[model samples]
Target: LDPNRLPRTIDGLINALTGELDDETLLIIDDAHLIDEQPELRALIERFIMAQPPRLHLILAGWHEPDSPLIATARLRGEALLIETADLLFTSDEAAQLWQQAGKTLPVDFDELMSFSAGWPLALRIALDATNWRSALGLREQKSKPALDDYLEREVFARLPTPLQRCLQRSAGLRWITPDLCAAIDPTFNSSELIAELRRRRLFVEPFGEHGVRFQPLIAAWLSRRAAADPEWVHLHRKAAVYFQQHGDHESALYHQIAAGDPAAVTTFLPLARTLLAERRAEAVLDWMRRLALTGDETPELIEIQAAALHQLNRLEAALATYRRAERAFAASGDRLGQSRCLRGQAAIYLDTVQPAPATDLLRRALKLLPRQCGAERIELLLMQAENWAN
Candidate 1:
């Protein structure tokens, strides 16, 4: 009966076990993926399964689906049941019960915790048992969580095949990964197959929309941090930027461009800013500009766009300051049309604030900057000037 001297063949093993079992018995094989390459052991298990031994139950559990013929046959016959990650996820009630066991109540922001955990038991445990559960779920940039990192490195990432590992890490650069996006980033790998493998492994990859999937938030944050340190970080992000832009996801494109630290982010963001401002998403435009972190080299057009966005957001003082800066830059560059646009923006802001005198003065300066051929600009400036002077 010694484990070290177990019978090698199926018949020998069944014979050895026959006399020892009288009642229903259950045998569970964990890490079944490890035995996938052991043909002899696999064959023995296949034979044992086919025999359908009475009063015996078998459970094979692992991250991967085993490549077994008997299992496939049994699946078709409805004789074998599978419990996936979704089935095993902890519900809110289950999470509450865990907290009850710890002599505490669930946090008020329970939904956010759920997002961080994605119902994974290990993640829930880590968050629940942390010194500050909020801090644990923060998963902030450049922060270290030895427990989660060790588990992901040893059990999750290290266990993956090299190609799959690379695919997973590279795909983390995108907010929502699609086959086309992955193909753009890493052409050598079959993007669909790699994503399918990650899904099969239950590596926190979840269906996002019709054409996209996203890694669980915590896993994504961790993987993004790791990917940032990779040599392909810039290349991957650049590719993602191009893909998102091609797909007409301009916001995501702007995000990736800024993330890549590309000089072209400003150029890419300028047109998108106008759309965002037109849609009254002025705050979003400002946020993107903050991420861009432009120094003193802003193009007059970009400054005017930023000023307009600020004005839309009702940040009057900031808008006034930004518009003035744009006017100075345009004047320095000898762009009379650009300078006129800035003056008009400033005049509108002044008019909004009920300062007609300043508004009329700004519009008068704007009219001076436009040529006779600039018919639209002259007409717009004159109308503003006449309106402000009449007021």
Candidate 2:
């Protein structure tokens, strides 16, 4: 029966499930996060638990550790059993058994191999395939960097629709992408349909909730490489960055902006880092600034922004280094305005570190670099120098 065609009421769901399924029926709902948003469905599940028919069992699987309302309700009524995925991977003996089952002779240090995989089934399986079990003693000696990307490119990306592939690339730009933002990026595409297609392919696109999705770390890394290769797709990244910035998702916004290669994104992200600094979120600010540096195309203005962020985070040495880099880059580009700015930033760093002589030298250099006709910045630099000396 089509659930959508049924009456949109709790009675309809209870009637449908209880009437259609046998008392002995066991239903497994994987990815409960996706279904929880449907209050009617949650209510139906709740009602089933409350009714408590003999031999009826419901199993829910999700990444989140917290219990949902449905899970809590079922547990309260003594009707649900919770099993964590971590418990299912393997014990050392079990891992050895798996290796033995694959017709591999174990090395003396075989336990190390199992520990390295952390009992992840996929990693174990991949290791088994990559190593020659018949000559297992030499397996440890044959340290191979697995071509994980090649495997996914063939197995995963090859199977997705072009639009879904584009969506995945855009998602790589974001730390997280919700369905609404995904819809915004490709207005003509249906998020529901695309998500279903991705799930069917087992592409690591896990539901964040009913309204959002996230990529597994390995998959996110792979998609980022592919996205970097295609400059045309950068616009989708920019769109995601702007959306996240508007919603106050600063880290996510910074990620997408860096991926999109938008200069304006630097402006949007700098203030957030400053706010984080103000709140004593110093470590977080440093992390974001490091990410900004990795983008590898810093303008003098961007470098100054990064230096200021670093200085606020109390990373005085890194701030000085960034200022020096900005100074060199500006001089190479012959951007005198940028050079003057870099000099002033370097002077500030020197002042903060109590290196008054160097600070005075930098200020004098900055005054010279500033166009004689442009007196405003020169005056500001002199005032800053005077204040530094006073301190």
Candidate 3:
């Protein structure tokens, strides 16, 4: 039943449509959010929805959560169907399918666009519609960005309360936001009431996991664009870094520190990289080192971390080149330990690439440079030779 086309009563509409429905008919009401404008019509639907024929499914579709008494009653009776934006959003795999169905070559930035859109339905639809998919892979590159932003303002962001609006703008730089995380960034987040209000309104945030909530990516992206222009954005990232550090999520902590753009961000990453590498998160260690060292001050140890990460990701050519760079830097700096580590990184790539003779030679050099105790690297090299000969 719709606002304009209802049969004067909910019962009348049901009786009129009953003869037309099948045993498994599904009825979807689009723009169900519009029901809020006609309170009597919403009440009529709420009163009769619970007893809708068992075989006839009723689906209400809306961008914002429609305020209907039926929602609560439906939930209390276990007859409700709640389809969230995340549920409706297109997945990356689905996006790939759309690409093939459209008969277009996959864009080089396919993964990047998938992440940037966070699988929002509208964004995916827009990307899929592009005549030049490669050029439109970036959200900003899409000519319809203005249309998307305007739609967001009308259907999403404009519906949020004032306090939540401010919270979103201030905390946009954060990837994941919870009440506690916002409290860490914004001193004025007096209570979780702001969160409660958003929940009550059924806007931007999604109650995720057992005790967690996440911002809808499209809404969060708009907030981030606003946040990036604010002077407090740098301060926000710094606060997030500290919070992540306290929680022992060191990888995220280091990323925020880098985003903070403090001159000493480099100093923080170097030591953190050692811990990360020890934890076998070589990719993160390498990324942190490379990003922090981009302005200047490329350390031998950082280059070694890069080599280790590339090796872990199986980019043998790049890893081998980085290992050689590290070896030269270490030799110039007279660091025997650094030289030995570089040799090991090179040897691993050589073995993986089937250059067994070079792998054996690097292992010999590493063992000779390493002290007699040699430890794990020595044991690793001996094992590599054993495996090589066995093959």
Q: Which candidate should be chosen as best, given lDDT against the real structure?
A: 1
Query: Model 1, 48-121: lDDT tens per residue?
Result: 78764677788998887677888988889998898877898999889989999999878888888887887889
lDDT of 2 at 157: 68
The per-model lDDT (C-alpha) reads 0.80, 0.67, 0.72
TM-score of 3: 0.70
Better of 2 and 3 by TM-score: 3
TM-score, per-candidate, Cα-based: 0.75, 0.46, 0.70
lDDT of 2 by residue, 1-391 (tens): 5676544454555567766776587667676544434665565556655664455566666543232565676577875665655676777788788879989776565666565555657656666775443223122223442366667777666654578677676555555566678776767667777776566444555677776666665556556666666776688887777777787787777777877767765676667766775786766765776666644245565566567677776788888898788888889889888888878878887787778888888898888888888888878998988988887
lDDT string for model 3 (137-158, tens) is 3334344444566776676667
- Model 2 is weakest, by summed lDDT over 10 consecutive residues, at 133-142
Worst 10 residues of 3 by lDDT: 133-142
Whole-model lDDT, model 3:
0.72
- Candidate 2: the clashing residue pairs are none
Comparing candidate 1 with candidate 2, which one achieves the higher lDDT?
1
RMSD of each: 4.7, 11.1, 6.3
Clashing pairs counted in every model: 0, 0, 0
